[model samples]
Target: MNGDDELSLLSWMYGHDHDDPVPAPRLGQGYVELSGGPLDGSLLDVTSWTEDEIATGAVLMTVLGQTGPDGQARYAARPGDPGRWDWSGDAV
Candidate 1:
């Protein structure tokens, strides 16, 4: 494999330089509109969402921009460090 091929494989094996798909947002009951960040202009019609989905999303989004209980930013400064990735995908 070439250098690019090896890099692509490594990226896929880990989270680095990856873009995992978030669930496709859809309409349901109540609605939410994301006004900023990568989700800018995204709308959530929570009506169709399962309670578990909403709960999971709620907890995940809440910590993305907030300090932890100890007050450190959710992400680190040189966050590209492999150990810094939140593999569990839990923020709080």
Candidate 2:
């Protein structure tokens, strides 16, 4: 896909998880543009990200999926741990 198309895809992915409480870093506030696409370019797909946003995206993607890099779910609870049962195995 073209660059704009790719950026659009990234933006959509970034914005997909409405239930995730982890807020994406504010773009202009946390990062400055050196050179690239439109200043208002969407930071969703995977490409159009500031460094902080990319880190956030990685976390969001992992949480939305069942298992993360270590093969564990986004959240886990130890047996006998207080409030342990509240975690869903599949819920992002």
Candidate 3:
């Protein structure tokens, strides 16, 4: 038939068809807000974070404007605050 019809057929065959035209979900959907640091008020995407990392209460992130030589910043997640991570200090 038409080109659009053919394309739709191919998409369905390849499992690329979607019932809704809404955009797909973005990467790092789940995020933690930085409380204190150079990245204060910034959101760190932790969607890919593992359970162990979350349980450890610590997340080391490398970001811009870091005065440290290594450019790594350390943060600690507080209890009852899953959406926020407090800056502890520089990692290196």
**Local error of candidate 1 at 37, Å?**
1.2
TM-score of each: 0.27, 0.18, 0.55
lDDT of 3 by residue, 12-74 (tens): 111113464633333436656666766565555567779778656554544443565446667
Q: Candidate 2 regions off by >4 Å?
A: 5-13, 16-58, 61-92
Model 3 spans > 4 angstroms off? 1-28, 57-66
Please list all clashing residue pairs in model 2, or write none if there are none.
Answer: 9-45, 10-44, 10-45, 10-46, 11-44, 11-45
What is the clash tally of candidate 2? 6
Q: Extract clashing residue pairs from model 1.
A: 28-47, 28-48, 29-47
Each prediction's whole-model lDDT (CA): 0.34, 0.33, 0.56
lDDT (tens digit, per residue) of candidate 1 on 1-92: 79843432333121112354633332233544333332333333456667555444432233244443322222211133322222232343
**Candidates in order: C-alpha RMSD to true structure:** 14.3, 15.4, 13.9
RMSD of 1: 14.3
Give me the candidate number with maximum lDDT. Answer: 3
